[model samples]
Target: MLLLLASLAFVQYVRTSSSDQNPYLMTDYSRLHPVKVERVLQGEAEAQLIGLVKDAKAKGLKLSIAGQRHSQGGHTYYKDAVVVDMTSYNQVLSVDPEAKRIVVQAGATWEDVQKAVNPYGLSVKTMQSLNVFTIGGSISINAHGRDIRNGSLIKSVESFRLLTAGGDIIQVSRTENAELFPLALGGYGLFGIILDVTLILTEDEVYRESTVLMNLEEYSDYFQNEVLPNPDIRLHIARISVAEDSYFKEAFSKNYTVDRSLKLSDHNKLKSNDNWVAPGKLLFNINRSTDWGKNAQWNLQKHFFVEQSDKIVSRNNAMRAASAFMEYSQPGANDLLQEYFIPLPQFDAFVQRLGAIVKEEDMNLLNITIRYVNKDDEAVLSYAKQDMLALVCLFHAPLSKAGQQRMKQGVERIINEVIASEGSYYLPYIAYPTLEQFRNVYPGYEYFFAKKKDYDPDELFMNYFYEQYGG
Candidate 1:
């Protein structure tokens, strides 16, 4: 009883400290870190980058870049930085259906790119599950999605145009200006302003949807024996229910495999089966506030969502944004995100430990979605150091000091577990992890910073995430 009281007190302390430190109420989704910017800029042409950089330099102001601002961390802005809002200038520059390549303005949303390329029967090679995210934002974070074969965005990118802090626009690819490629891909917008990117596209695949129920222990072997071996399966994801009846033991796997019976033309003729906007957005809002909401969501998924026996979809339709596109928030409460990549072999162990921390702590964990990530050494600060399971969690926390502290403690515990498993946590969400934890997860920080200096010697391009860890 005493410990519980102390825990509540600490949570209140954390919320108070966070509120005191964050002076402004304006922030991204998490509402955890609020920052004031000198000014914001928007433009429709590449020429705007030159003036934005020059003006910031002339005024001795720091620069921060923003897209749709979906990232939970203060990575979208820094205190007193000049924010460049990239959404209005969005445009799809080029689409080559035959060659499977696309050139898009940095701010173009995946939905914009999709609308342009869908007619040609082509699809993005890799991206986040959402279509509302900007192309540049996705590339900047090196986002990944259901396509296990495609890996991260770095794997699909052919090249990109970067506007340096000095206002020089340069093209970067694997062989041309190679070092800049990895740095900017996942640099969290600390290196340069992304102007445009050329990425690989794929022929839209017709897929048959399916799901399977599995216990937590059977996941690793099932993934190895059932998921990976099937070449026909193109998109895969998993969900483990956190309800009282299921907890960590009950789970379901979702997959989309090539539908051999359907021709590309045949798919084009089919009507859109679902928008996924209404149900997806509805459930997302419910999860933001109550325990019953979370359980209700899983109940629906278990009973209704997992019943997919032979639903078919085009690759683009399958890739459409669902839950991630929702823009909902509850006052005095924040939706927080944490992601950890546990090495594949340590999957079961990681889950068991995770269960204890979450349950014992009684964290307001609202959602847990898992994905497979192949080994990726492409990004300098790569989270996938080894083949791993990317477990993404969404938690709802009250604005009270105690709630915030509880969240902080929960995040730290998860981070420690990930580190002990020889894995790494993602940097795009939450500011709870320590600078030391950042260094520990991404040992290449010094090297990445050194390379960053070559392009941004003035340290002009920055966000709260970089300002915290780049030191």
Candidate 2:
């Protein structure tokens, strides 16, 4: 009882101390590169956005698009640029249950879409595991998650309206403005402002959660022989232990299998609030602080998931995974995410090398979640060149310059291993990997930047991502 009270007090202290005071400076979830911006404007009416773009172009000012600003990299804002906050423009434009499709403003979050379509027995086909991110940001990064059957987020996008640097809102998809379809979807906001998106929806399903604990080396075979071939399994995710004892040697797979015998209505209630955030945050902070905490977290997770085995949940409910527990707000330190996509054939080999590097560099890795991404080359900047397993890793990093430099060096070493194993690192995180490494992983980058020039010749759309690698 005393321990619980102490944890709650610490949570309150962290919350009260983490508040931001500078209104003129902008940074992302990483809190690493705070820069002064000309002004931040809330995206409202379409006409206002058009005018903003026109005025920026005329004034020779660059514009950056922002949505929740969860991207660890400076993909959302730049120095002295006008940052358009898109969350306000969020609205579910339309939903066609019969057609299994939905159109929404770019600023609309996955939560908004789920809420709007839940009544009609619909859910998003693919998105990040958490539903807090905006549709624009998800597509901008071309995110993917637990659902192994649907492929990456781009595969589910039907179309979207782009507000170009030239102040024109044009429809882009497989047919209309077809040339821009691939370029803009995963184009990382360099192409233009994504005004609204049309997405393909899937029917909400009832799933029975199941978990299997296995050695890390057994995961590749288990997934191929067991998980992939099983048609009943709709969504899957796995976690590799980061504790001092097991480290990356231990893993457990969580599968949500179709339960046709269960009624969807019984499990379809959406998880609207994180009722246990305070305790969850406290536990996670403990997990972040020490080796003992890490071991405890790993064991607790195994017990928790095993206990919840056979739990029934709706597809929409499962998509709304608990993320509030992972939120961190320390003043000098923050949690950051980096992902590496490895071809299935090399998963074991790559993980071995990754574990070795992390140990040698002494990186403060908190967690590693594995998810499958089907071969997708539809997006020009797509990460999944072949059927791959994505290692979504979270690390607690310090904001100091020396700390950042050390983190960069360690990350670059990991990227080296990734590239050697025919893998690719995700671009939405910090720009830690060298440009050479990025080009080696993403060979199409040259053409991608060229297309950016072709579309926005004035270079009106700007962010640190382009500044770092677009050259």
Candidate 3:
């Protein structure tokens, strides 16, 4: 058996302008203590994967699988572990359109398989912002988009080929290995390495999209009543104001343009240079972060086909953005992110308190991002439950260490408040929460730890996450 190791040392460099210092935010890591892994096992089938697993066991090298390494958590990369780089295994095994299913190698990214099925006039129902994440990686984390109707990407999976810790090849689905199926959805690659997956694809359709800026006072209503109820409304988000008059009235006059109106909504929420607009607004306001008001025009389009090819391109762009994005989750109204996953029944109250938190905190919120997701049963830790999930990312910039500390402290407070109210924080981008906070955030963590131990008993697949959570 040949061993292949693609050294990751070359991509490490200090990029000062970047947002997140963590390597998990990028394909490469520079800050974390540089650890070298002997990358082995290039590509294989169930039998072949089993053989490799057996070989690793014989060599006494605890092994870990590598996909796109897009996860923000450190689960995908290691310092001195034996890694199986699955990228070489990229392949679309089969596409059974008659059954509305597609089989693809675990190493393949969404961009890979989506393009393969383009001619078939099919598309994936849901996807995260980036396309570079592998099918296995996303399934491991149980990632989902802002769309409420479409929950985690794993829900589309009909079945999977799993290479377990015992070096056994097993077929798992809602029935076969049923308990492990949903368990693995957000399992974080602790139980087994996915060899391949069969996903149910959706028919192609067009999307009508738009971005509107509304006042903070109306933020809760807009999200709960309008944004949450509509599935056709693909991506909906709100950016809040942190600074005074940061939303320059003259800037809006200069930048606001409706490029393609019919394709998107005519909704343009702008506060003209009216009394509401103040100086220093751009520096302090949440809306100033995106500065949508600064952009003279917004793209609006309708009847645009959601073809597989088109989605592939969009997903690729999402990856580029993900790679380049400086670490900032969307900002919310009160200078903080009071995100919550209120059951649909409690949405009304959720919004009301959401606004009150911002006000009481004296946080000048600009826009609140409103994301809708279908109730999904993928990951035990996933935020996709019975209600629409809303993430309020509050931003305050020229980010002084003291100010950041204050904001982060406030964020912790808000997170605690939400958890007390039965909400979970989005774990990927979180930077300051403690292990106890993490435990509270995901009550199913005990099960997650058990799965990790069952598969990676030796703990060779280690990272900062394992050390922090003791998982």
lDDT at position 90, candidate 1? 85
lDDT for each residue of candidate 2 in 84-165, tens digit (9 for 90 to 100): 9999999999999999999999999999999999999999989998899999999998989999999999999999999999
Alpha carbon lDDT at 118, candidate 1: 84
User: Model 3 over residues 1-471: C-alpha lDDT tens digits?
Assistant: 011111111111122234433433322321223356666456656667777777777777666666865444456555555667788787999998877789988889877866776556566766664566788877777776543455767777888988887788889998898878877677666677788889888754333334344444555566667765654554443443333343311110000111232321122111111221122222122234444532311111111211111231221122222322122322221122334555545555555565556556654454344455666656666776555555545344323455556655666666666666676666544245777887887777887778677766866445445666755
Q: lDDT values of the candidates?
A: 0.81, 0.90, 0.55
Backbone clashes (count) for model 2: 0
- In candidate 1, clashing pairs total 5
lDDT of 2 at 115: 95
TM per candidate: 0.91, 0.97, 0.68
lDDT of 1 by residue, 331-352 (tens): 5776677888998888899998
**Residue 70 local lDDT, model 3:** 46
Q: Candidate 3: misplaced stretches above 4 Å? A: 1-33, 38-48, 227-369, 392-411, 459-463
Q: What value does the lDDT take at residue 31 in candidate 3? A: 26
